[model samples]
Target: MLTLYMEVSLTETQQCCGDVEMLFRRWSVLGLVIPTLLIGACSSTPEKEEISEQPAAELYLESKQRMNTGNYRSAIAHLEALLSRYPFGPHADQVQLDLIYGYYAVSDNAAARAAADRFIRLNPTHKDIDYALYMRGLMSEDEDSNFFQSMFNIDRSDRDPAMVRQAFGDFERLIREYPASKYAPDAARRMIALKNRLARYEVRVAEYYYQREAYVASIGRGKYVVQYMSDTPSVERALELMVESYDKLDMPEAKQDTLAVLKLNYPDNSMVN
Candidate 1:
């Protein structure tokens, strides 16, 4: 093409000087004009085919095959490489989903959480977003979420409340956002377990003070349970302890008030009322 154009241009220039026939003979001898056009046409198709194609389905099948064979790491390797090369690959969602399970199979909680976050961020409106978020919560959940342990750890200077709060909050957020999520029942059940454990811990702490005959301290701790830990199962016991503490302190009016609250709330509780 270049050779022909150059000869044609030269021929046009030459024609203006009355040399037309000689330029055409020169272009024909070099054969540049016909060959270049044919080669250019032949080369175009392969480029277009390459651009308008994908290996996404093949990659997904290979990863799934490896996963089924119990080769999770190999599957991860394939999927991860594909993600970098084809961000909008057809198997993008499946790659992420399998990545989560693969990380779990390899006992890599950090990777599992990362994969879950990536999946959630990329597929915000995905039907499986709730599952991804829930998996993230499970990946990071710690002992502090156990209400029995949380109270003692809450004041632990070495522990970070931010991490614990985030883990629990994710579960709570999932429950609120996807109220009908399959995981919602389990999440709510976990909250109930947490409440029960915390309630028991409060009662145990109050009893410790009571056993030491620190009536005022015992009363304060019981009041703390009633005021702050009201949702816990220990509320009933703490109210009874408050009554006992007030009686020992010879505060008759406070004792009467405690008894009234206990009676009003649990009229069938003969032990306190």
Candidate 2:
């Protein structure tokens, strides 16, 4: 009986040892995998840190190269990243300016305008303030025009002139404040174009009133163009409309006065002839 008990005890000891060996093998596999995963995770962290710690000068150069290649979208990404990483770095101001142009290139006019405004507000005396003002004016110009209006040579004179007026005001302010700036000449030219557009818009309204036989309203619109948009090409048409409206209203003296002015200004005009 004692010998039989010892055999049973030895068998139980052998089974317990087998179970411990299997558990040790599983733990060994897990230990190898956990270290491998930890090493991989540790290795990846430095790589990300290296990428995020790219120097601002290098990033700016990369962005410039992208922009030179007309890859403005990629340039924008790099610029944005650089700005995010180094907000008060040496390239902060220039980065803001580049971002404005980048947004403009992508036709994100609202973003461009907002960037410009922020730059102006932050750096009111910046050397590139004139450039920002000019860009702001340009972004505001024709902002409401649709793709079809741009694709086809449709007349925008009859459309809403709110944006056009805002653009004109922007250009005017730029010229008024920084008359000697390099961009001032271009701004002045754009202002002239805007004035002509506004004059044309007023003339169209006058024509509409005339077509509806609203002679007094037509005369008022035409007179406004003559007074406020004197040098514009539409002034000639406005004067003619005024003369015609006055005649329709049976105001002989006013008709003769407007006719005389139109003839003096546009002698070869068909209406004057």
Candidate 3:
């Protein structure tokens, strides 16, 4: 009876050991599989989330809302995404125009100009072409002067005239190409101001030359002002500058002729007196 009990106990112990070994193997496999499964799940979730594409129409609405709420950056994000995803969508052209406005609103002149140029080049016959041209002219005008200078009454015309001339050209083009466009009136008014400013710039340069006793250079700039910007208020000053320059150069005939013109045009002008 004692021998039988010992053998039975050994057999039970061996069975128990086998069961534990099987459980260990199953747990080991599960450990490796569970980690791989977890890793795969984590990796796939981000990709799925990242690629969640919104419809182009939905993006347009979202961008419009952001713009209405004055959230320009978010509006730009939505607009850019829409453009990337739906290049040929119904709202593509409108989105491009809005981008130009948004960039201009944010004071990003370079991007605004680039977007306007692209729009004009791509959609020559678009109904909104006038608007694009108007916006382009406005961008150039802003480039030549900022709010700070306007607020402080600083003279930006005394600085570079490249942007000024560019703006004038754009405004002139807008007026010439789209005479009946709603933006034409404003563009016309702006062109007048720009012309005056350009004339003043020429006079300022002439004055600088005169101050330095460079009579020839001064006379050249004066003549340019009178010839190019004839309708501007600076014409009187330009004539005066020419007269002074001619006097300095000892050219009596030119001085007398310039004074005569100045007196005929601006009879009460103190410069002529």
- Pairs of residues clashing in candidate 3: none
Question: lDDT per residue, candidate 1, 33-110, as tens digits?
Answer: 543533443322222112223386666666666666555556667777767678787666767877886665544667
Best of the two (1, 2) by TM-score: 2
RMSD of each: 26.4, 25.4, 25.9
| Candidate 1, position 116, lDDT | 87
The alpha-carbon lDDT assigned to residue 32 of candidate 3 equals: 43
Local accuracy by lDDT, each model: 0.64, 0.75, 0.75
State the lDDT of candidate 2 residue by residue for 137-248, as single tens digits: 8888737454455567678789889988878888898899899988898889889878988998999999999999999999999999988889889998899888889989
lDDT of 2: 0.75
Where is model 1 more than 4 Å wrong at Cα? 1-54, 68-70, 142-167, 200-231, 240-252, 263-273
The CA lDDT at 29 in model 1 is: 31
Evaluated with TM-score, which candidate comes out highest? 3
Worst 10 residues of 1 by lDDT: 1-10
